[model samples]
Target chain A: MTKYQRIYQELLDKIKTKEYKTGDYLPSENELMKTYGSSRDTIRKALQLLLQNGYIQKVVGKGSVVLDSERIAFPVSGISSFKELKESMDGTIETIVEEFTVVPADDKLKDELHMDDGNVYIIERVRSINGEKIILDKDYLNGNIIQGLTKQHAQDSIYEYIENELNLNISFSRKEITVIPATKHDKEVLDMLDYDLLVCVKSYSYLEDATLFEYTISKHRPDKFRFVDFARRSQ
Target chain B: MTKYQRIYQELLDKIKTKEYKTGDYLPSENELMKTYGSSRDTIRKALQLLLQNGYIQKVVGKGSVVLDSERIAFPVSGISSFKELKESMDGTIETIVEEFTVVPADDKLKDELHMDDGNVYIIERVRSINGEKIILDKDYLNGNIIQGLTKQHAQDSIYEYIENELNLNISFSRKEITVIPATKHDKEVLDMLDYDLLVCVKSYSYLEDATLFEYTISKHRPDKFRFVDFARRSQ
Candidate 1:
């Protein structure tokens, strides 16, 4: 690892261990430089990384202060799998596969998935947390790339299968969040009643090589949907 | 600027200028290396920065594909000011100040803002783009740090005043997005009659000194609210 990366990781570990609690100020630049035996620039670079990662916030007069880590709820800021998201949260989550089929890409699918002409696998699932249905996920994956998707894989974690079984590198994603009126499909699948609004998340998942492999529309019940993000000022 | 930053900026300029139009593949690493007289690793670093900033998506077999930049509408992924947001969009925008007052922090406000016994300046405004009322901004700024708030500042841009006049470095923010049933305040102030749902964005903005300086609740008409984010996998 790079020097700055090592420093950043060490500081992050300190924050995670509660050695540097929330509202506590970190060591000053001079102190960190002395302890790490590094230059001010190097120390600042490490601090910048920590700031970007939402571990600490730099104060003008004071030093970097540890932010309340508990405040980050349902981190939708980064490209993460459902399994990873479940691991981060506290609850027994279950995925129920509603439908799994391979179909030719229609005009709407072509426009939405940005694919010219191909067959795509459509997987419908309802995710529940502690027996409460919250999300209805409809995924359209490129059949050419993601082959042999079965109902068993859908019931489990498709992302895990894609990564472990297929050995495909899930690289990045472009996500758009909006609120829309709940449709009949959403109401039926999510078991949502009297919830007029659904938080819709449309995502385009890309492979490591930058191929857009999957398009998903996740409809979430309004009360159950909350997206949290940590953002820095773009300089 | 560093070599990688310079290269990233140059490539971004090319994309913006349509020298590398949308759907066009960027030059290969070898070609970029030859042109820039840089190492392969250095070129890759430049390309990685471009990918992070959403200028280009690297396709495995197809090199880097220029994504349609116009598809990103009103980016809520980052912590940006209203003035900055307006500058990025087209059409005339106006802000109507509804209320401006200085009030002592209540129990809820104190806890939410992370402030002790202190006063706060509450400002409410309605934002219109292309003569369409879309956003309702309710900002509660710490009176100690952010002082001298007036109706003019609310009508203009309070963020601009905070940065320019107050000379405070706005650092970061934690944002939470959810859909809620429109309240009476939202209906009356935002001139909403038929709209049932509102996209609610609650944000806590901190200064460079790691002090929570402001708390804002931005409510938007469901149809008009959209958030776009470009995210990479955490390896």
Candidate 2:
């Protein structure tokens, strides 16, 4: 492998072994170059790859620091709803519910929510990190879950009230993410249309006994969304 | 809602309910115009929305046929890999394992695969449907599952060989899909460079005892890939 590649692999190995945890600082460019016996350009290239892959992030003066590893953790398994996950996260995160209503689920909605036998509660909202809108959440809830949900409740974390207040046991979730165009509604919900692309994450959540609890379709601004996975060799 | 939206929703409702199944034809423009009592331009607008969302596909001389719903029906309780799912779909598919090697499972990799100990086998591949490259797969397998795999054998379906030849029972998989730009290698593997967009899919498979057997990552040329999911609302 080339010198840069070698260094990249070594750094990856170190990160994997937990030599550096999320938010941990790494050596300066000069130090990394000195240790790896490489030039600044080569070292920068390696760092660029990690940044592009969402592994490490750089601050203006702080140099490079590990990101929150959980940000790109494995695709959720089993029953946790996006609503539930959002609720469970730190309270600093906020949501601006854009639309919520009782609409007959379309075939796409029916197929996604598995609502072949009934109506669906469609809720659309945007999630904010700090104060910036980063994710647009479009969810379909069984009318059975919340009989009379309104737009007022959607403005906050719905999952919080469902589990903490209503006392429902939220368990596992299956999710998928894809890219799509930014629709007019997306522009309105996010309050900005500077970007042209959106990353869509679709998820299905189930209860403790394996009963489906929530079906959510979310869209994130492409530049803001990152996904990560851990993999091993099969025998 | 606009008159056009009303027409669009009505048509969408029909397709969602399987009032039109795959390969089933819809009424012509003139027929729809009369039924919805709208002008030609208004009717066209409604039809355009359906086409944009992939609900119906229009043919040149034959008109429009209800497109197959792209939502996939995944057996949530079963322990099957994408390899097995394609195989059961029969010889209509082919796979080319591009690269395979034993790699150290890093913290991110360990976390994603839940591999707290030991090494992993990393496998990369492309899957084709009827000779068209549709999915690019990158996987990490548990070393204990397939200890002595050569790169040559990895070229074929590893899951099939594991179950039919090795006698290891492959059971359940948790998967996620997303969209990404084509990497330099993606161009070489998918054999395209002009289109920099790709759809990425990842799945984590488990053995009968819940041991993660494999972590598979796949990418596809977006225009050519359509995902199907059978979703259910949380109860």
Q: Pick the candidate with the highest lDDT.
A: 1
lDDT of 1 at A181: 85
User: What does candidate 2's lDDT look like per residue over A61-135, in tens digits?
Assistant: 767776544545533332344555655455567777667788776788777665676678887777887688878
Q: Evaluate model 1 with DockQ and give the value.
A: 0.60
Question: What are the per-residue Cα lDDT tens digits for candidate 2 across B44-63?
Answer: 77876675444565665666
Q: For each candidate, report its DockQ versus the true two-chain complex.
A: 0.60, 0.02
Minimal lDDT window, size 10, model 1 chain A: A72-81
TM-score (C-alpha) between model 2 and the true structure: 0.50
lDDT of 1 by residue, B1-235 (tens): 8897788889989988899998899999999999999999789879877776677888766698887776655377788888888887889898988889999999998988878888999988899888888899999999888888788988878889989999988888989998778888788777565787788899999888778899999999988888998777763
Of the true interface contacts, the fraction found in model 2 is 0.00
The estimated TM-scores of all candidates read 0.86, 0.50
